[model samples]
Target chain A: MTDVASKEQKLSAEENISSKILTIYLIWSVIISVSIIIVGTILFIVTGKSGYNMENLNSLITAKGSLSTYPFYIQSIWSGVLTLKPFAIIQLGVLILLLTPFGRMLLQVFIFLYEKDTTFAIIALVVFAILLFSLYMVNILEALHIA
Target chain B: MIYIVIGYLMEILVASIAAGIIGALGGLGGGVLIVPFLTLYFHVPISLAIGASIVSVIATSSGSAAAYVRDKISNIRIGTFLVLFTTTGAILGAFIEHITPVKVLFFIFGIVLIISVIPMLKKIGEEVPNVERNDPLAEKLGLYGEYYDSVLKREVKYKVTGVKPGAAMMFMAGTISGLLGIGSGAFKVLAMDLAMRLPIKVSTTTSNFMIGVTAAASAGIYFFTGDVNPFIAAPVAIGVLLGAIIGTKILVRIRSSSVRKIFAVIILIVGLEMILRGAGVI
Candidate 1:
């Protein structure tokens, strides 16, 4: 009981710093991404055109439409960004939304290692490895589709 | 043409807010509601619906977790420790998503959800769990913490046990997240609150924190599949984020026991719907 209390006190002191950093970072990213999404949605509503095509809105809402096989490649997303396309901009927000957790996990693994918590550090490493592997799996799946 | 788009976007935005609130409260990741709403009502392609739901789940988890983690209520130790299982499970589930029929997947997920609720129903209104057993792994990993309960006006400390089983359950939770493009908060909460013997609030907020990481892995694959359409993702993300923020606010003020009951009921309803839908009745 006393040992538990001592441990709690120790964590609240140092763990406090990392927790604060995570909170601020998460908040800012969500704000940035949500802002971008709002702007992109507004731009599309007003202009009726994004770099891809205004017609995409048709299939977008259509039931069981053509979106299944259409994979929005990162390369195209980059090109779309260069052109300031609204849909691309929104996808950028989506990308950020997707990346936030990746960032958090990476940050956590670093923190665990820095604190010399080997067990958690190793666990976090495994999680990080799995995260990276999932991305690669996507490419493999896409390739298999082409083949 | 513009009006139609406006209507669709507006409707989704409103529905997503409700989904976001429920998801944040229950740690569900919001996909459970979003996918069905998009498909059954809007006639969205299953792939597209899955894509959008995965993205929205990310939004809800991150949005709600911001406060929970900052407040130190989310148990970062346990969250980080458990993420390994979920991430691995999610990868497998995402791969299976490509091969399996979604209805069959939802049915299994539904059964899991319903089963999880039974344990929770017995302990509804429990503010803090009284755990007697100790797991050496949990102790070595320091899987215990303290948080302030604003509603109770007291500091609550909790110890963790059942490390192996809880981790096993988290893997299933992660697979459900990947399979359904949801946070699978129900399963996560059950794993912690039941298997791991955590306080309901701790279980919920920690689940909220972990769901994002779990969903993010599979969401990556969904991205390239073009399941994540910007048109669908945009409003869902925006509304769910807004709603999740609201949920976190409500969470701190309510009694933990009530939170458990709410989680139980929500699980019950969503589970039944999924089963019915999976059976092609809906």
Candidate 2:
């Protein structure tokens, strides 16, 4: 009975940790995504243009200068964000939303490690690696002209 | 330019809000609604619409998932494990997206939406399933969870099985999501509920958790490819996020069977419209 009790306690403790981590991640994601979107919307209204013109819609559709040269654009996004460009700020918000799940998985890796659950920790690590690989492999493949 | 910008933003915002509400109710992500709406009604290019839709998927996933996570409705272990297969599939699918023609994408999107409706129609009004047996693989992977169902007013416990099959289905779901820029939650739920024998609530919530990660995997490719237009994506994301929050709140308070049926009908109509449009018959 005592052994069962101890196990239950451990499970609850783990649950608590998981819940806490998720709550923190969710809060940050909401704050970041919502704020940037609002700023972007307001700026979009005020400026009456969104960096990309309607004339470029055709080029955007065909992906003329975008996909092949995406890495440079990604770099520009960083600088744009740092400079508080409205569109970039909006993109940054979407970026944060996209990355939140990746962040959560990374947190799970630590949580599993702390629990001494080696199998699940390794599983989490593998998922993390896949996410990171997918993010960067596009650039490499584009450079190789194999994409 | 000002009139064009306002027109574009307002249209996407309104469309996204509708998609978000419909998506949340359906347990599918907003991408399903946004992609077709953008391409069919607004005449947005398929790739940019898809990019914006993918972003909206992440927004809805994160927004609704927060509430689900807090309620302990989502099975994180199952979601995380499946992410391995889905992410790999997403990468491959993203590559396919680059090479596929717009017409072909429309055809596939329409067909997929139609196909998804079949399962929903069959499972309409079905209650949570009972699975008494557990697979050894599930035990090893620790794929069991319990959540208090607010609607039922009781704690529901479930164990998963068919791990290999579920993972395979998730791979397919991920590929479809990447290719079409939708969440493909219907397939994810089917893999869990039908193949893995998990309860419906668990399946839906866990699928929600998984969608964000799967979309994230492909979102990177979309972002770098300049497919994600901030002007289009920004309002869509915000609108969908708001709609999803409201949907999540509603999800916990009501019986979902009726909601599922209503959502199914909506999906069926949309699916047929997409097919007709793609076939150039409309």
Clashing residue pairs for model 2: none
C-alpha TM-score for every candidate: 0.92, 0.93
For model 2, what is the error of residue B105's alpha carbon versus the real structure, in angstroms, after optimal superposition? Answer: 0.7
Per-residue alpha-carbon lDDT of model 2 for B1-282, expressed as tens digits?
456657767777888888898888767888898988888887778888888889889888987887787888888889889988888888888889988877788888888888887877787666777777778889988888788988888988887788999999999999999898998888888788778988778888889988988998898888776778776777888888877877777777778677668677877788888888878886
**Model 2 CAPRI rating:** medium
| Chain A: TM-score in each model | 0.82, 0.77
lDDT tens digits by residue: candidate 1, A1-147: 999989868867778777778888888888898888888899878887655544545665642212232226777776766777777788888888898888888888788877778778778778888888999988788787820
Model 2 chain A weakest 10-residue run by lDDT:
A63-72
Best prediction by TM-score: 2
Q: Flag regions of model 1 displaced more than 4 Å.
A: A1-10, A54-58, A62-71, B109-113
